[model samples]
Target chain A: EDKVVQSPLSLVVHEGDTVTLNCSYEVTNFRSLLWYKQEKKAPTFLFMLTSSGIEKKSGRLSSILDKKELFSILNITATQTGDSAVYLCAVEGTIGNQFYFGTGTSLTVIP
Target chain B: EAGVAQSPRYKIIEKRQSVAFWCNPISGHATLYWYQQILGQGPKLLIQFQNNGVVDDSQLPKDRFSAERLKGVDSTLKIQPAKLEDSAVYLCASSLVGEGITFGQGTRLTVV
Candidate 1:
């Protein structure tokens, strides 16, 4: 079974603070790693990391994958109350179309 | 152009009752996925389809749950004799093979 583990299951930060979320996975066949931000309903796509070392960024959120280490990190800077949500990391297995997700890290940004 | 769509934003049922949810993937998306997400947790894949063919469904509870994507577009998930443990948000997503999947708003089911 493919397992995805995330550190700091929950976090709280004041506005303008920066936080990093970690995700490590052990899968038989690895293909892609994805990050999502979920509020109340559906999760919104944030980034998809396919290569190692190269960081992908959008506004204040950025992420990087280390394939050799079998891990990834999502960084958020200048966090706002709107940034308070569950950050999820998922990895697609090498053989099937299935993707296994981590339990997620709940982030709370205080004003 | 449009995102994946799911129906009955919320549902409330009693134990042992049966319920069903629907999904419509984005146009031209050849791959579709169904996921179950409990509160405070990430989505878990229930099934996947590619062009009307089953790609994966190892996590689905076959005895009480069944799903289908007909004509490679719209899909439905049905649950019989619901249990409290089955209460969760059912999410529908679609992708284009190499691309990442796009999710629907999801249907939250509450079992009493």
Candidate 2:
């Protein structure tokens, strides 16, 4: 079975603080890894990492993948209350178009 | 472009009851997926449809959960004789091949 695990199940931080969430996966035929931010409703796409070492960034959020270690990290810099959300990690496998997801890391940013 | 659309923002039912959720994918998306998200957990894929065809459903509970995308565009998922354990948010998402997925607001199901 394909599995994805995330560390630091929950965290609390003050505004302007930085946070890093981690995810690791074990699966065959790994194709890509993705990060998503979910607030109250559904998840919104953050980044898709297909290659290792190269970083994908947008505004205050950035993510990088380490294929050699089967892990990925999402970094949020200068966090604000609006950044409080559950960050999810998912892995897509080449076999059968399946996506395995982690349990997610819930973040709370207080002003 | 418009994002994915799902209906019945929330529903509450008793065990042994039936409930259905609907989803309409983006105009040009070829792949659609249904996911179940329990409280404090990430969304888990329940089924995937590629142009109205079942691409994957390994995680779906076949005995009571069913889904169909008859026209290859809109889809519906039904759960019969729901159990308390089935309470969760049902999220619908769509994507083009090799593209990032766009999710709907989701239908929150609460089974008592």
Candidate 1 residue A54 Cα shift, in angstroms, is 0.7
lDDT of 2 at B4: 95
Query: Could you list the CA RMSD of all candidates, in the order they appear?
Result: 1.3, 1.3
User: For model 2, what is the C-alpha lDDT against the true structure?
Assistant: 0.93
Candidate 1 — which pairs collide? A29-A94
Report the error of model 2 at residue B67, Å. Answer: 0.7
Worst 10 residues of 2 chain B by lDDT: B93-102
Could you give candidate 2's per-residue lDDT for residues A1-110 as a string of tens digits? 67999999999999999999999999899989999999997998999999999999999999999999999999999999999999999998886566788999999999
Cα lDDT tens digits for candidate 1, A1-111: 579999889998999999999999998778899999999989899999999999999999999999999999999988999999999998876665667889999999999
**What would the TM-score be for candidate 2 when compared with the true structure?**
0.95
DockQ of each: 0.76, 0.74
Q: Which candidate leads the pack in lDDT? A: 2
Cα lDDT computed for each candidate against the true fold: 0.91, 0.93
